[model samples]
Target chain A: MNLLHYLRALRGIATRELLRFVHQRERFISALVRPLVWLFIFAAGFRSTLGLSPIPPYETYILYEEYITPGLIGMIQLFNGMQSSLSMVYDREMGNMRTLLISPLPRWFLLVAKLLAGTLVSILQAYAFLLVAWVYDVRTPLEGYLDLLPALLLSGLMLGALGLLLSSFIEQLENFAGVMNFVIFPMFFMSTALYPLWKLQESSDLLHTLAEYNPFSQAVELIRFALYGQFNIYACVYTLSSLILFLSAAVIGYNPSKGMMQKKGGKQ
Target chain B: MIQSIAPVLSVQNISLAYGEKLALDNVSFSVHSGECRILLGPNGAGKSSLFSLITRLYDTRQGSIDIAGLNLKRHSSKALGRLGVVFQQPTLDMDLSVERNLFYHADLHGLGRKQAKDRIQEELERQAMFERRHEKVRQLNGGHRRRVEIARALLHKPDLLLLDEPTVGLDMPSRKAIVEYVHQLTADHKIAVLWATHLVDEIFETDQLIVLHKGTIRFQGSVPQLLDTTATSSVASAFQHLTKEVR
Candidate 1:
């Protein structure tokens, strides 16, 4: 209704998420641990076998840890976005989403606000993961940490918007495992999260083109450049456009009158 | 009989269809301030579909609904602001404390901090739940949880209160308490209520009743009028006599 009203509602929605996140210690632990295990165990083993030439963000050849750090950060956000969407699915199933949907606020605004709340949580996780990566000697220039903030915000929103898009389509909680298999794995593996596009090209031109076009790859590239205190206009533009595309589709998909989620949930 | 100076809730020629199946056909109702109008129907009698229409969970394809004089389609914010709902299923976050849940709802409605606090306290105290405000909702029994939901719904001081089978699973004592409390609410606050239920025993003598069967209204009037028309001695028999055409 007013600016203050909007602010208050956003604060409430974000605070509810924070409270829920705090209560789920297992969730926080799992989110953090998933990325770390890859950084430590997976990257450690791959570091020797996966020698890389200097990528755009990298001036010299780097270890697999450095190469995959941005990928892992992308991984954190990718999973966080889906995790947030999973919560939305859970809320719909549990009837809590109806409470949110019934709020006097505009539904698009509520959903966008929900998307933003999830981005905030994922950013926190990104920074925590960065902290651990720094401890592992995958250090960025000191200013890169500050520079990474906005990048994390942008990439986080894109991935969270993707999650919003997915949550809008997913009807039940039981379909979560299937979504992870279909959405998460393909997006992660087919992207530059673990390797550069050129490397994929050396292996397979088809996979290389796919990785180059992958929005997750662009998000990782965006983060990869930012952490080195550089800016990739291409990655920035690609990621932003993808975010807009995903968010628009998500908002439309959630409309009661026209969207695919027209069937009321929780009664079943 | 349900109309007042102006209806708090007005549903005009509302019909809902799921593919070829008509869930509601030209159903219409209005509730004025201080009126408790019951939508009595067996399962799949279009009660949920109608509630979905009122709540804007589904689009109003063939009709319009106005709440507190604001069109739900054109001015949903204002209309929704004047509405309070306790859905059929539990919607509270099990991990959040009672006050936390209520406060979050208040925030969603954009209630100011002081106003939210005061209303939360008043509503919780009214439900005899102020003492347990710090307790998690998961700790509350089914009846108590329902009470908390009712309290939360009333906190906004809505002009129209829609309860979709709020007492479905409660024990008799709890159900009776909620029924009595809601009746008092409309009386004391002049709020219009649309309570959907299948159980006949939950009906109060003064309440206006509408019996729905197969997506159409079978009967709607006073209890005595229902008996008079059906030539039956009791509400249950009258309901049976009215809906006996089910095949």
Candidate 2:
């Protein structure tokens, strides 16, 4: 395909995703509501009990809600990422994916278009949640907003790629709930989304080690630092590498010859 | 001397398997422009598998496939670009309007906005759905939805059109309508058609037919030739006789 055609395909696919998101108003509401509830109810409940030593970016101690704001943004994107994969599973079952796969574009290009589209949606959700947080008095510096853009995009891509990788392995929509329980919940809970790495270390060495290696933790840390206009190189490298690994796995899984979807005994 | 036109679709020695169970064994066929080739088979006869191979939904381990002279393996984009497909399942985005669905397909094919709009208008009008173009696909009946899908497939102006059981679940009139429309597409547009179905009534005596059974081609020839070989008066009886003999 020519450049114009590639651009058109990207625009069409992305616009379709946006249109689907718009029609499903409840999805937007619930995506925003889930984190806000955590920001308000969970954070408020834990605020008094939790104590923090001044972390590097902060000169003084921070409120629990303020500390967890970036994590909540990551949470919003993580859920949206999985939700997009759920739609992909539905698309496969409904045969819409076949139509997409039949497009003249290279399969990888098509997948990248889909991943980018999902990431765009997640970014929109992240910004909306940030706006709500700002209104609720969990304010970040003005420059931090600009810095958060790239972090939000990278984090979104990482989580979205993970979702794509999972979707490629998941054959049926009926089994997605199990994945949500086993994968989503574990990835969210085991990561530093809810607590700092130091807190996990204080609790258990094993848990701390797990959190330290978690890609989701890397993503949350990336966003957390970016929200304060700070760059975390370790988190950046970790998240970028994870994005490439998961995305390559997803692309392979969707390959008709060698991927997970390939029929055994079929020509490789 | 007249020069022969190349076949729009050519599948040679294509084989597929699902682990130990063979789905297709050394299947081969070709369809030329303006020809309607019916891949007639009963359920589990590897009709879908063959369609999948031709459409590149699955790869061929043993053979090669070419679309409008473009090698599928070596020039996938060009090969795929020359063909349009309608799968056995309904593929329309139910939430999108009929027009939007066609528009999306046109965009996927790289058609510009103006050209896509014009082609969408023409196809919808041709399908007698122009009046309802703005309606969501979910609002349309099965036949209309199938028609919309056909329109979407044709927006790219493919030289070959692959339809896998395009009339599976429709009423008799709807089924008849789709069959006739596709036949008309072959004749009027000179589009090669590979239509896979198990229904005996869908086959016409003049059309090319390939009888597939249990992952192999039981017969490949004109419908009349099939009857001649099976010593049966009708295509249905011939189909039964051939498949039974193979078993």
Candidate 3:
């Protein structure tokens, strides 16, 4: 339980994750391609056709590409979190996770270390994506860059925790593709990923309410507010509360006594 | 063995199940410091399941497990600290050098860089892997990779070591070398060993043997005691005779 001890463990976990990113050169590049494809290809096609009312935060006419920059960053965090969790499940199947599980550390500490490690990687990807956006003229406040770190870290942790929770219950790794279709796509698209929640309200009242209450929407708004150099109390509260809830669920899901992972004797 | 040796680990009537499917039923065994106990069983005989329960990789619904007089459930991290386990599969990273692989493990155990460096050197030397420490595991032979795993397990100086099918893919000589090395550790360092495997050849005459079948302990005793009445002389032949008779 020593602080130095767990910090060392956290470093190991983070280093291991970074190594995976290094070895799989193609995977590292492909992770960026998915979000860019959504930005460059899909967003470009929809920019002229989509009608936009004035966004509250927008002082002037903002390009759709600039408006969606925060959402794309959120997209990168969300997918990267799921991919990290998928890798964990893959490790469980491949026996690497057993190495972590069998370590002589408290399970809760191990869980937190893993979450922080994954979140660190997710934030790295998000920053890299933001750099690409900057070149493309997707402008935000100069100080916005400094303010976005905590928002990105919290959103990454919350999404990673949710992914970890799902991993504990996922029957098999093959089911992960199904989860992308069911859990991830809906969470991203049904939220304010491409447009504001208020903008969705013009289309359908039911969709607006769903978007307003969505945890994913809260994450997007938190990051969006931070990206614009503004503080939104409700978004910050919602993001932090969801982070706590998801992290608690993830910890409980990995509990050796009751978690679905406890069934160790079944076929690997 | 010490003149007055105490048991390093004790398991009493531990039974485990998955819903209604029983995985281990009333399993009990013990090993004193400096002793080696071999678990001989066929597939689905609960050898791996027993390892899982002992390591607390999974919890048990029934019975108690104590390591160095501490209950496993009450002081899991403390109890687990005394245990070093080599799984049935290769768990080391293929891309990382042997040293880096062990370094990652040392960090997980919370050892400082200097301390971990010293321990890693000592352990790799103990397993005769120091020469190959800088080589990526993928470049090494299967036998050498397993040696790296053994070295990794020993980094923390665990009191009890559990190896589940540790020599699954190694050649005969490599397997024998590992077996002899572990035997030497038990004698020289007074470390307890739980070596689980289906191959009865892994069980030496001096070692205690447990025969697990269908999630139950079919037999447990010294190799001599188990084979004394049989006409066969080797542990493998004795196992064949006993299991055949039971069947």
Candidate 4:
């Protein structure tokens, strides 16, 4: 209704999310550990096996860890997005979601606020991943850390929206693990998260195009460039548009009159 | 009791279906200030479905719902602003303290900080939950948690309290306490109540009743009128007589 109400609601929702994140120590540790595993073992193993050419974000050849840092950052956001939506599905089953939906605020505003809060939390995880990576010698320009804030937020928003969209379609929390595997593995492997588009092209033309076109790859590129204090207009625009598209679809999927809630309520 | 005043909640001709199966059909009811309207029904009698429509968890397809003179579809914020709901299931985040839950709900209703704190204290104190405010909801028993939820629902001082089977799983004393508390709300304060339940023992002499069965209203009137029509001496027999007719 009033600005004060809207602001307070957003604050409460966001704070709830933070409190949940803090309470789930295993989740926070696992979120960071998943990415750290790749940096310590996966990248360390690939340092000699994988070769790299100079990329837009880099002036000279870089090691595998350096190359995968941005991708790993992307990985953190990607997982955080899905995991937050996973919690949403869990909440719906538990009825906390009903408490939220019944509030006087517009549904769209609530969903957006939810998406934003999830994205912010994911951004925090990404920074944590970045911090660990930086100490591990995956260093970039100091200003890169500051400049990449907007990029991470946008990328996190897009990924979180995608997760929110998937959550709306999922009926049971039990069905979500399979869906996450189906989505996460393909989206991660097909993108430039593990390797560059050129490397994919060297292996196969089709894989090249898929990686090049993948939204996750664009997100990776955006992070990579921004980490070096550089700008890539194409990646920025692509990620932003993907954010809009996914967010709009998520909003639609959550609409009570037309969306998933219209199904019979033998269970709410 | 403010029986002469306009109804705080009015539902007119609300219908709902899931594809081919009708969940609720042509359901209409109203709740005036100081009135407690009980929606009595069997398990599959579409009680949850109707509550969903009222809470806007799902919207009505065939009719309109108005709360405090505001149409729910067009003016949802204003309409919902007048409603407080405690769902069939416990909805408080188990990880968050009781105070946090109430504060979050108050914020959603636009209560200012000092005002929200005051109201939270008042409602919690009323429910005998103020001493346990800082405890996580998980620490409370089923009855205590329900009390906290009731306190949270009242933070905004809504005109209509919509409770969906709030005492379904509680022990006898807890159930009696909740029933007494809610009845006192309508008796002392002018707030209206729409309580959905299958438990015949929970009904009071002053309470109005709606007997719903298989997606339709079987009967709607005061307890005496229900007794006259069903020719039953007690609430239990009357409920069984009304519900078992079509079966």
In terms of DockQ, which candidate is strongest? 4
What is the DockQ for all candidates, taken in turn?
Answer: 0.70, 0.69, 0.74, 0.81
For candidate 1, lDDT tens digit of each residue in A147-216?
Answer: 9989999999999999999998888899999999998999999999897787888899999888889999
Candidate 2 structure quality by residue, lDDT tens digits, B116-181: 999999998998999999999999999999999999899999999999999988999989989999
- True-contact fraction per candidate equals 0.76, 0.73, 0.72, 0.82
Give the DockQ of candidate 3: 0.74
Clashes of 2: 0
- Name the lDDT value of residue A207 in candidate 1: 95
Instruction: Tell me the docking grade of candidate 4.
Output: high
Model 2's chain B yields a TM-score of 0.96
Q: What is the lDDT of residue B78 in candidate 3?
A: 84
**Residue ranges of candidate 2 with Cα displaced over 4 Å:** A264-268, B1-3, B245-247
Which residue pairs show backbone clashes in model 3?
A: none
lDDT for predicted candidate 2 compared with the true structure: 0.89
For all candidates, what are the clash counts?
0, 0, 0, 0
Give each candidate's interface RMSD in Å.
Answer: 1.8, 1.8, 1.3, 1.1
* lDDT per residue (tens digit) for residues A36-72 in model 3: 8877888889899776666755667777787787888
